[model samples]
Target: MTCKFILVTGFLGSGKTSLVKHMLSDWGESARVAVIQNEFAASGVDGKELKLANDQFELIEINNGSVFCVCLLGHFIHTLERLLDEYQPDYIVLEASGLADPINIVELLQADELSERLVLDQIITLVDAANIERSLAMLARTRHQIMIADVVLLNKQDCYPGDLTELSRLLRSMNPHAAIYPTEHGRICLSQLTESSHLAAGQYYGRQSADRPEQLSACVVRVHQRFTQENLNALLAELQHDCIRIKGFVQTPEDVTLSFHSVFENCQVAAVSSYSGAAELIAFSETLTSKQVRQIVRRYAS
Candidate 1:
């Protein structure tokens, strides 16, 4: 059987991980799932959130860059081919990095490597209702994500509590063809996840990878020293900036590991009982360099 390919893309902190988790839990019951988790950071923090059945699903992580970028596209194709050959999964769900430019999806589906083996099932893009306005204004890729989606999920509705009618209208203006749905915590009906997108495979709009900018840069920051919850909050507060997004695991003074999630200047911290990775965060910024992040981390962490 040809593998069904579901590509999930969205901006940072847009509930992409939550949506993927929901899919894995709900869909894995019937279909064999293989997830391609492409993370911009070296640490696959988002992969940790997926609750998988050992026999029902498998995960492949392509980290440290966008899979759509020239930097990782070749590797991405090769990995998919290998997974299809060895695992023979029924569904291939790709959780692309927030910075990914998937405009070349049609070109990829038509590639000599994946054409016969894979079928494009759907292009689901999640829009963080609370942050969509700001993201649309500040990031070009945000518009691209919406423009190419077969189904657009206006997620985090509970957090927004604003005028979604207008928001929906704006999103429709971006892509009149896409089906739009309001969702909270990335919740959506199972049919939406399982149904074929009905989009013509070659119907992709002309916008391609050349339009994506390589302005964003990322680095992993590891802290061996433990911190009180208070210190950890203070440290993130000091470093929050308009150009950056951060997420990963943090070590507590009690030797516990806590998850950290930040978008722009806002963040949410929570304790996790199962985390085992080093207390390191992957930070991405449009203007900050790796050396600069390391210096800032040293100063604030000290």
Candidate 2:
């Protein structure tokens, strides 16, 4: 039997992980689900979060680049093919990296290897209502994400209580076929996603370029020594302006491992060791070079 594939896309901190966790919880252990999580950097935070929420589903991670990129496409195909052969799950949820440009999604499903085994079930994209305007202005890929989605979740609605008439109109104009739902904290009934026989148009609009734009870049650094929470916060504050998303695990001076999730102006730090001894912290920024990232680390990490 062909496995149903759900492609979930959204910009950084749009809550894609929360939605996947919701689906896993709703489905329960009886459902055989496999999740493919892609991250622009080798920070194992998201994968760890998924396992913590529900360990029943098989989890796979493709990091350091988007699965759509030519550099990582070969490895992604190999990993996925092996997973399909080894564990035949009922559904496969692909959580794309925020920077991922899924313009070639239709072409990907039609690939000789995956076409028969995996069916394009639905393309669900989450939009951060509060930051939608800023994200759209910052990146063209954000618009492309909505254009190809079968189901578009205008997530983080509580963050923006103002009238969404204009925003909704703009989104509908991008993809008239997509069903847009206003959601808080990315929570929504699974039935709403698949109420129709066809959720997505399965077509990408505007620029069909598969190339990941050069502006966005990710830098990964190992946090070898423990630092004070204040120091970490300072580093986050300094980076948050240029870096859109900064996350990973950091050790405290008192030997406590804390997970950090920093998006734009907000930074959430928790004393949770979700990952397995992975101390690499990653920061994604627009137009920030690797050297600059290292410099910032050196200044604060001292």
Candidate 3:
């Protein structure tokens, strides 16, 4: 059977992960589903939290870069093809990195390589109701995410006690064609996850606005050597100023693999059994350059 593809896009802290988890729990019992979770950070925090039966669900974590970007588009295509050939899953869900532009992804799907094997099912964009106004004003990526969506989930309603009518009007103006649903913590009816005939049309691209300057950059570091805890701490300290999100796996001197995740001022490290020993870090500030990122990688990676 041809795999149905669902692309989930939203900005950081927008409850995309929570929505994916809910779908997995609710649907895993009945259908064979596969997931491709892409994150700007190298660590697989969201992938780890998605609980599904191994027999019926397959999860592929593409962390450290946006799959829609030039850096990882080839990798994304190869992995998607591999999943379809080997697993033959009933459905495939792509949880785009918070910084990803869903429009580029839709264009990629129209390419010959993926068009025949997989169908562009729907684009689900999750909007954080409480921060929508601020995000839309500050970030161009946020607007693009909303513009290409077939369904918009205006999530975090409980936290957003302010006027939603105005917010709804703003979202409607962005994509008058999209079906909007107001929800909290990304909770939505199970039917929304099911197949829909609303495949995104290719004509939308012609009318899209010109590309905007990218505010986010993903710098991936692959390390072969193990690091001491103190060494890792110092690296994170230096990155904290420029990076808003940091994640990936690190090997300690003792040969233990640990997952690393940092968002803003907060950081979390946990021991894990297996990892690629590669670090994918994302910096929000435009101040970060490729040269500086490579220097950091050269210092830490063996």
What CA root-mean-square deviation does each model show from the true structure?
2.3, 2.1, 5.2
- Tens digit of per-residue lDDT, candidate 3, span 1-302: 67889888898768888788877777856878899998876555567556421335798999777787777778989999999999888889999878776676657876777888898778899998877776677678889888888888999888777888888899989887778889987888779645333534344654433233366665655556667776777777778778766665667778777666665555667777645334444444456775686577558543
All models: lDDT?
A: 0.79, 0.83, 0.73
Candidate 3 residue runs with Cα over 4 Å from true position: 51-56, 193-201, 206-213, 217-302
Per-model TM against the reference: 0.92, 0.92, 0.72
| Residue-level lDDT tens digits of model 1 in 171-282 | 9898887888999888887696555354632456454664345577777777766767787787678667624678777777677788888877668898887666567777
- TM-score of candidate 2 on Cα atoms, chains taken together: 0.92
Q: Model 1 segments beyond 4 Å from truth?
A: 51-56, 211-214, 299-302
List where candidate 2 sits over 4 angstroms from the true fold: 197-200, 205-207, 273-275
What are the per-residue Cα lDDT tens digits for candidate 2 across 199-273?
344544333545675588888888786668898889889989888888888787777788888877867888874
Q: Order the candidates by TM-score, highest first — what do you get? A: 2, 1, 3
Clashing pairs in 1: none
Backbone clash pairs for candidate 2 read: 150-199, 150-200
Better model by lDDT: candidate 2 vs candidate 3: 2
Q: Report the candidate with higher TM-score, 2 versus 3.
A: 2
Name the lDDT of candidate 3. 0.73
